[model samples]
Target: MKIVVVSDTHIPKRAQRLPSRLLHELRSADQIIHAGDWQSLEVYEQLKQYAPVNGVFGNTDNEDIIRVFPDKKIVNVNGFKIGIIHGHGKKMTTVKRAFTAFNQPIDCIVFGHSHIPYLKYKNKTLMFNPGSATDKRKAPFYSFGILTMSDELHAQHIFFKSK
Candidate 1:
């Protein structure tokens, strides 16, 4: 299965739309996961065009988003257990979040909030962050991620140069 992971879009505050590169990546993905801080329903709607999307509300999101999205969730894909969260607590880093989720029977943890794209392996679980799709503060950057699942699951972060 191919899963696209993204987060912290912040939308109008960062860019006018999702980068074309991200859209292209999503088009080929089997599923989509948005970590949070979407900032608008339009973002969610836009993502839906690429693939089926599941997401949670970030600290910056409004009540409507909170009501619509769960704070955390678990998805079973092709026999692999995947956990998703926005990572807003004190231990917000990927490693920390992965460790916290280690208690669960999950094979991977996907999260975002700091707007930095990263992939790490903790013990047996893969941890991933898709960065900010709106290029919030770091460089003229935006990105999305792809999780490749087979016998061994792997994560690849794809960056988008802001246009």
Candidate 2:
């Protein structure tokens, strides 16, 4: 399965629309996952038009978004257990908090809150943060991610200059 991963869109607050490059990926993805901070349901609605979307709600999300998405979730894709969370909390680093969110074993943890793209493995679990598609914050470039799963899992970050 081909999955397009993104987070912290903050639409209308960050950018008016998703970058064309990301839209193209979403159009071709078998599934789409947003880590959080969508800001509005319109973002979700827009993404759903292209592919199935699995995601959580971030701190900035209102009741409308929180009503549809949880603060954390686990999804099974092609025999791989993936944990999805919007890593926002009062204490501890986002990555540290993500590791503690799930009690069960998970092959990968996908999170977003800091708007910093990250990919690493710790304690044998893959940690992926797609950063922000519409909001780069202080980052040099806007970015997103893609995950391809078959016999194995492959994840990559795609960076660009535009929102």
Which candidate leads in lDDT? Answer: 2
In candidate 1, the residue pairs with backbone N, CA or C atoms under 3 Å apart (3 or more residues apart, or in different chains) clash, namely none
What does candidate 1 score on TM?
0.90
lDDT by residue for model 1 over 1-163, one digit each (tens)? Answer: 8988888888877778888778778778889998889888899888888789988888889987888898888888889988888888775555586458546777888888777777877777778888886764754566778888888788887766663
What lDDT score is found at residue 104 in candidate 1?
Answer: 71
> For candidate 2, what is the TM-score?
0.98
> Each model's RMSD to truth, in Å?
1.9, 0.6
**Per-candidate TM vs. native?**
0.90, 0.98
Backbone clashes, each candidate: 0, 0
**Model 2, residue 95: displacement in angstroms?**
0.6
